[model samples]
Target chain A: MKAWSIEKPGSREVLKQIDVDKPEPQTGELLIKVKAAGINRTDTLTRQNAALKKPYPILGVEVSGVVDSNQSTDSKLNAGTRVCGLVNHGGYGEYVVMRADRAMILPDELSFKEGAAIPEVFLTAYQTIYWLGELKNEEKILIHAAGSGVGTAAIQLAKQLSQATIFATAGKPEKQEMARKLGASVTINYKEESFDERINDVTKGTGVDVILDFVGASYWPMNLASCAADARWVLIGMLGGSEVERVSLSELMRKRIALKGTLLTPRSDEYKASLSREFMQIAMPLFKEKKLQPIIHTVLPFEKLPEAHRIMENDENIGKIIIKMNQ
Target chain B: MKAWSIEKPGSREVLKQIDVDKPEPQTGELLIKVKAAGINRTDTLTRQNAALKKPYPILGVEVSGVVDSNQSTDSKLNAGTRVCGLVNHGGYGEYVVMRADRAMILPDELSFKEGAAIPEVFLTAYQTIYWLGELKNEEKILIHAAGSGVGTAAIQLAKQLSQATIFATAGKPEKQEMARKLGASVTINYKEESFDERINDVTKGTGVDVILDFVGASYWPMNLASCAADARWVLIGMLGGSEVERVSLSELMRKRIALKGTLLTPRSDEYKASLSREFMQIAMPLFKEKKLQPIIHTVLPFEKLPEAHRIMENDENIGKIIIKMNQ
Candidate 1:
């Protein structure tokens, strides 16, 4: 099996393709012949030794492929079934093991690359928006990195399943338009203008009900400013920095807003499986309904791993970067 | 008219007892003859030039008194009505003007000092538990600084409304006992042991469902560790600071927990009034039924302003501290 292994965490230079023995499916696990995988910001971070514990790290949390083998005959999924599921760190390979319950049957119309891009970001946006964000109809939503994968998924979901008004933020005009096409009510160029001022102006000083943020320190003050009374601030990634600065408790209390930080892995297996199962359930239907579509910025062959990482690190890509495993 | 005024934002030296023109009720407002005022942590923070943009720093936020004058025929209340409500500032005085809708009619059986304490902490805990925390019976709740006025209020309210398994943390044995009497299922002396470890041990590795935290930065790590799967972390204060040295994003996401920093003041007038009106409806009967009582530490003459601030800053007192305008 061909896999990208972190020989030692340092920079993108450390990620090297190496030959490895194929893994076998454990009980209740499905062996999937990896076809495509998505590259995320965290994948870049993991390669740079910025993980909970360094070394022995494989990139990619999202995967799509045909099930090569099934551990149990009683399992609902059988060999040759097209599927997608979240992985611990082993998705960036020719073959990977996925839990049977976490596995979702990929639609016939969807390609492996599209299935690959759906798991990590779609599940994250789904859980954060409905579970943590608790977004409902008529509520105002402020998505910070609206052109990114999670932001794109959230916009489409809020557009199709919920009636909430979506306000998205991006640095460039094209990316902002991408959010608008995905059903964003308004787009704010956070680079050119003050999001807090603009948000207040747009919402008539009522502020937004929920905020989905990726830029950490840079967005904290404005995140507070833009959030509505009893608003929920959901933070998944902090591209700018992690350390939050001093905030005025008076301003916070007045709005009764809550800042909730989140991530999608490092959760127990059961927790991960639940999200994976639901991604297969709720999000799969939406994918089939064409209400949501996975946007791919570039499809790089597994050999061009270094170039993909460089593109992501520079924030040059608007949507997900997919890497197809072809030998 | 007599009142306590802070000529500037600074230490207790700025808190001066001075004669000023009594506040007159304008259209759609009420003039309240303040019998008792509750001093909260916000009051102490305001006096020390700590509140957001503190130039005209008047101290109090919660008060109970008779309606001295009512200029709003739009409201149901008359001039002789007893009421309690929350305000941004300007509460520590002989007469204060409030929007007619903000006032909650006080029960005849409750003393003015207790009523004053009820408005701030009770409303704070009510929102934290019901609206933000969404605490239900049989679920686990951890109230940090469980002996403080808000903590005590949360303890009693959780017992009365939800059958939540309440765990409370206080620095002293006396305070822990007080928390237990207020209906805490278990009381932990945070000074003696690690709260995170205790929380796990008490729940057998499943942490509390909801946490009400005031000691922010110092406890952020433990707060994460103390949360159960899908836990709600609510930050109400940061006496210990606001920054955590290391934040595990993966851990936050895996558990599907929501971390939120919240403040109970500065909400829109309409929002605050709605909360007040809801709380007055739900909790008014509890006070009259003797199910809930304001835990007052001491009532001092308004001239002893410095002592009140000192006691609150030192964190030595139990429950709330009250100051009488006339004694």
Candidate 2:
């Protein structure tokens, strides 16, 4: 099996393609012949940071593939069934092993590239918006990094599930337009305008009911200032920086704001299995009905894994970047 | 009518005895012949901050008294009924006005001083532990300021409602002993030892499930460090300082901790009414059974209101400080 492995820490040059022995499925697990793998910012950071505790040298977290083998006798998935699922590691390989319960049957309506992009982004967006944020119908929401994978997914999910008013922020003009097209009632090019002021204007000073933030510290003040009373701010990533400058505890208390930090990769297998079941039950139908679709910015060959990382690092993609594995 | 008014902000000396026109009960409101008023940190902060937008000069927030008048035609409360309730202001007076719906009929087993201490502390504690923190039976919780009004109330509530293991932090030895007497399985004198280390030692590095924190910035790092995976840290006050020194976004996300900022005074009357109803249903029976009781440090005459504030500022009280009115 050929896989992209982090040869060293700190640069895209560290990613190396090497041949390795194919991994076998463990109990209640399935070996999937990878068709496509999703590229995420987590991969880039994990490769660059020497201090991160990597479980494996391989860098991918999500993949779409065909079931090659099932270890458990009671496994529902049969060989050759198309599936997409999250993996702790080794997704950026010719064959990857994943827990059977976490695997979802990829709908015939979706392509392998689309399936590869769905699990991480959609599940993260769903968990944050519905489970953590508890976004209600008719409430307003602000999605930061609106051009990114989870941001686009959140917009689509919010639109399809509820009558929420969506506000979005992206850096580039084309990305902003894409967000607007996706279902954003207001899209601000954060590079050109203050999102806080824009939110205040659009909401008539009441502010948005929920904010999905990836840019930490740098946007902390703006995020706090742009929240309505009893607003929920869900933090999924720290793209900009980590240490917040100054937080007014009084303001947070007065507004009754809740700040929740979450990540999917570090979650337990049981939690992931439950989330997969929920996503399949609630969101899969929407996908089958074409009410929700994956927003793929670009799909590169598996050999060009470095290129995918470069594109993500430069923030050039409007949505998910996928790497198609060579058959 | 006699009342204590903030003559001008900046010190306890500014709290002055003044004569004011007796307030008539507005529609859906009640006029009470005040019996006792609870002194809280909010009162002290309001008195010190000249910039605070006070609704009225009178500072008290919770009161217990005989219902002198009811303005609503459909009001369940009648004249001469003993009631304890939350007030936006004017509680530190011979006569006070409160929303009829926010008033709870005083339990026969409780005294007026005890009733006055109950509404603010118990409601705040219940909202934090049960509602915000979502504490479960057999889970562990760390309560800071364990000798304060809310802390004492929380200890009692957690003991009666759930089999939660309570860990408390107080500044003084006597306070620590008082916390243990109430229900805390372990009590730490925060001034004498590192709470974070103690928590780690006690939980064997697993950490506590919920943290009820009021000391903001000073305890922020410790709070984050001491929380177990998926823990909820509920913040109700910022007695230590408002601005946090530094926050690690990675630490917060890795732990999946939720930091919630809350205040009871700023909530809408309808919201408080709902909370009141919930408290009555879940906690009132415990009071009747004597399973829960308000811990009053001292009950002084109304003229000694300034002395009560001094005691609160000096952190001299073991539990709630109450000021009683001589009708």
Estimated TM-score per prediction?
A: 0.70, 0.90
After superposing candidate 1 on the true structure, give the runs of residues whose Cα lies further than 4 Å from its correct spot: A50-58, A72-75, B1-126, B134-145, B156-173, B180-210, B214-231, B236-327
Candidate 2's displacement at residue A228, Å, is 2.3
Evaluated with TM-score, which candidate comes out highest? 2
Candidate 2: misplaced stretches above 4 Å? A6-10, A13-22, A48-58, A68-80, B1-23, B30-33, B45-59, B67-81
Per-residue C-alpha lDDT of model 1 across residues B1-327, encoded as one tens digit per residue:
776767677777777777778776789888888888988887876676644463464568888899888888855678889899887677888888888888999999998988888888999999888877888778999998888899999999999888789999998998999999989988999889998998889899989999998887788778888988878877787767755555555466557676666677756788788998899888889999999998999998887877888888887789889888783
lDDT of 2 by residue, A167-259 (tens): 999988888888888899999988889999999998899999999989998998899889999999999888889888667887888899999
List the DockQ of the predictions in order: 0.22, 0.69
| Chain B TM-score (model 1 vs. true structure) | 0.95
Scored by CA lDDT, what does every candidate get?
0.83, 0.90
User: Residue A158 of model 2: what lDDT?
Assistant: 87
Chain A TM-scores of all predicted models: 0.95, 0.95
Per-residue lDDT of model 1, residues A214-288, tens digit only: 777767778878888878778777677766555455465557666676777766788877877766767688788
DockQ-based CAPRI category assigned to the predicted complex of candidate 2: medium
